[model samples]
Target: MASTLRFSVTFLTLLFSLWVVEVHTSRKLISIKEEEDQTISHLLKDGEFDDPSLYMFFRINDLKYDLKSGSKLPIFFNKDDPQKLPPLITRQEADLIPFTTSKLDFLLSHFSISKDSPQGKAMKETLERCNYKPMEGQLKFCGTSLESMLDLVKETIGSNADLKVMTTKVTVPTQNTVSYALHNYTFVEAPKELFGVKMLGCHRMPYPYAVYYCHGHKSGSRVFEVNLVSDNGRQRVVGPAVCHMDTSMWNTDHVAFKVLKIEPGTAPVCHFFPLDNIVWLTK
Candidate 1:
């Protein structure tokens, strides 16, 4: 009887060990794929967005994140390449630590948003696909992820909570290069009391736009944008496709928000927002 009992115990122990090993192996494999995809996406930020392998903007129309209340993303840059923009005045910088899934869940809760929500889930996945914070010591996100980063000089002199991104990716005409500029990404903060909790929300801006602009490309029937976050989502100017830059807030006829025009003229235009058309809501 004793020998039989010992044999049964040993058999169960072996089964449990195999199960543990299998589980660990499965997770490690998943993480490996995650790392590979994340790195490729980063490299692709400097490549053509129309590449068949990229899927960032390919599902733009299907991308339904909760932009109604505003952004829930960790504070990052408006561009992958800040050099493409005009030189900064001071060029502040800082090191950002990665926010783990648990951390994201905690922070998002303050906004009355759930990390498990449909949009929340999408953001989580997006964050995984990109390196939100730096690893080791080097800053890989400096010029690509964000144009500039604010120093964490915790001076309690301003608002208790604040986050803002006023820049966006754009294609420079004539030169035929991809770049970014301010698009009035406004952030409005209440007294931190929404649903009995603090919240900072987006206002008058599209959500993390980087892919999909339609203009006459010198190459191929279709021109791809570099650093386009998504290949599925795109914006095209209908009608005459006349473009220009107008900084005046009064100019509603302007094609883009807070941008310099590639071509200047008073040409009739019909803009299509198949992908990025988010606007600020006050109601």
Candidate 2:
């Protein structure tokens, strides 16, 4: 009977130790997973991660993390200084980052205005008049998406009495020689209605060829850049021109174009030509 009691006590102690070990392991795994998620969230908030760039960056870094099974967690070490780990950007802080000309320029510089063109003239005029404040109030009729802006523009122009606007579809070739058809708007009597509006000029750039123009208005000259490609390549940038409105308001126009390129390795490299020296947005 004494022997049996000893065995029972020993068995109980061993089971308790094993249980404690399992609990410790589980907690450690949970902590590591939380850290991994925080890291990814921070990078995304800082605009460091996106479609093509994110994929390439991850592959190049050889980052390995298993989100499933909760066994392994991805660790993010600072690329510049491996010893320091940065805190993630909070939701409130992320909201403070204005999605303005500066942000857009950093993401993509191919679709921008040249200082010499009429469109550039308009952009400069508007920027000066508004003192570079972002668009707000009743003048805040701009759309965030190209499709939404185009629809709004079509409706606005269609209701206008002085302007005769016609929306047409056109096919343009990108630098990679791929073709795409997109909606283009032509405003007849635009000069009479929009006195300062004019086709300033057009130019091209490598990887993505584009033409920009300035449309005059009471607020300022609205810059428009059209993309001339449709190959659906990896680095496709499709959006409208960025506009500076009077009263320190900045808005973008839907008159932007989409760029597509041919498949890689199949076509010869194409060089893009720069437009005449034009004013550029400053830091």
- Deviating ranges (above 4 Å) for candidate 1: 1-98, 131-283
TM-scores for candidates 1 onward, in order:
0.20, 0.19
lDDT of 2 by residue, 82-119 (tens): 11212223334434433344443332333365656565
Question: Which candidate should be chosen as best, given TM-score against the real structure?
Answer: 1
Quote the RMSD, in angstroms, for model 1.
24.3
Residue runs of model 2 more than 4 Å from their true location after superposition: 1-218, 225-240, 245-283
lDDT of each: 0.24, 0.25
lDDT of 1 at 199: 15
At residue 27, what lDDT does model 1 achieve? 8
TM-score of model number 2: 0.19
